[model samples]
Target: PRIIVRAIRTAGKLAVDKVKELSVKIDNKSPEEQRDLLQKCAVTAMSSKLIHQQKGHFSKMVVDAVLSLDAPLLPLDMIGIKKVSGGALEDSFLVAGVAFKKTFSYAGFEMQPKSYDDCKIALLNIELELKAERDNAEVRVDNVKEYQKVVDAEWQILYEKLATLHASGANVVLSKLPIGDVATQYFADRDMFCAGRVPEEDLRRTQRA
Candidate 1:
């Protein structure tokens, strides 16, 4: 068929043709010009949204958020969005840096330090809950004395892990796993900030920040 002949000729020509890069490079633009362009693009993108009337506010926030990144590659995952109740769309402004809500799994969270300056932060993926091994192995104990030993062993393991964490001098401890009552009390006793069950995205951003 004529179609097959045309395809063959086109393929032969393509095989002899040189490839060209098609990605746009916008590095020539000045910073101010780039910011203006981003603001305009942001406003245009939001034109169909409910808060289009507040495009000016949101567009400025978009530009500020993009400009705040200190990396060579801009990733959308690095940005976080938290919704606080009782705030108008116009009041929705961008936070300059990473911000997440407080989630306390245990009591005495108030006893911990409210804030820290120049303090080391540690990100953990391990669990600090005082429970049996994650394997769910049942302890076979016939008497109260043996049960006491089992509980003590669990406490000792938790204490060793906490001790290692404390030795790192990280006042702010954030973990993806659960940090239960005993760990929370230990942190409060030491006047350390501890937050558990943090989202992986927030942890990544915190690491970068």
Candidate 2:
């Protein structure tokens, strides 16, 4: 049997944040004041229990699935390993087989999202393609918790680098591509995030976990 990790999206709650801000009231506020308010609100949301909530919700389901793969590419390391959290991918098939599925599930994909007119096709194809890899190959997925901590440790270093770059105001457009597809958008997001473009609160939440 093929094993795959799946993540579910959870509703978020802002503990102190049921306050309704009317657009009119926001409109009356100066731009500087508005920026300040938003900053504070963002900080409050991060500081409150809501930070990294989705991660905790999702990781619980995905960690073991990640371990079962025969091979996996880590975004931070830019290489494939013989196992899910260590080593390197020797071929495109290996990367496609393991990394692709995890990325797809992480985005909270499903048949429901597939019906949307604007839903990204590349992302869906990623899921389909990885499933194909699993069926075509003899590889087996296993548990990766121990190696995952090391991978995560490296990922954090990369994330801090990217976050600092983004904070310096560097533009984050795709630098080069062989195909025109949002197909790789998540990879880009993961790379930047591994490098550190995820919203700060999200990063902090991951750090705490």
Which stretches in model 1 have alpha-carbon errors above 4 Å?
Answer: 1-26, 132-136
Off by over 4 Å in 2: 1-24, 48-209
Across 1-209, the per-residue lDDT of candidate 1 in tens digits comes to: 99999999998877666342434445898888878888988999999998799999988987888788876675877889998999688878777777888776688777889788998899999999876565867679999999999888888999999989899999999999999988988999998989999988889999988
| Global lDDT of each candidate | 0.86, 0.33
> lDDT score, residue 154, model 2?
52
Q: Model 2: per-residue lDDT, tens digit, 54-156?
A: 4333232233333333334322222223335544222112232212212222331221121223221111110111112345545333668765775566556
Alpha carbon lDDT of residue 198, candidate 2? 28
Best candidate (score: lDDT): 1
Output the number of the TM-score-best candidate.
Answer: 1
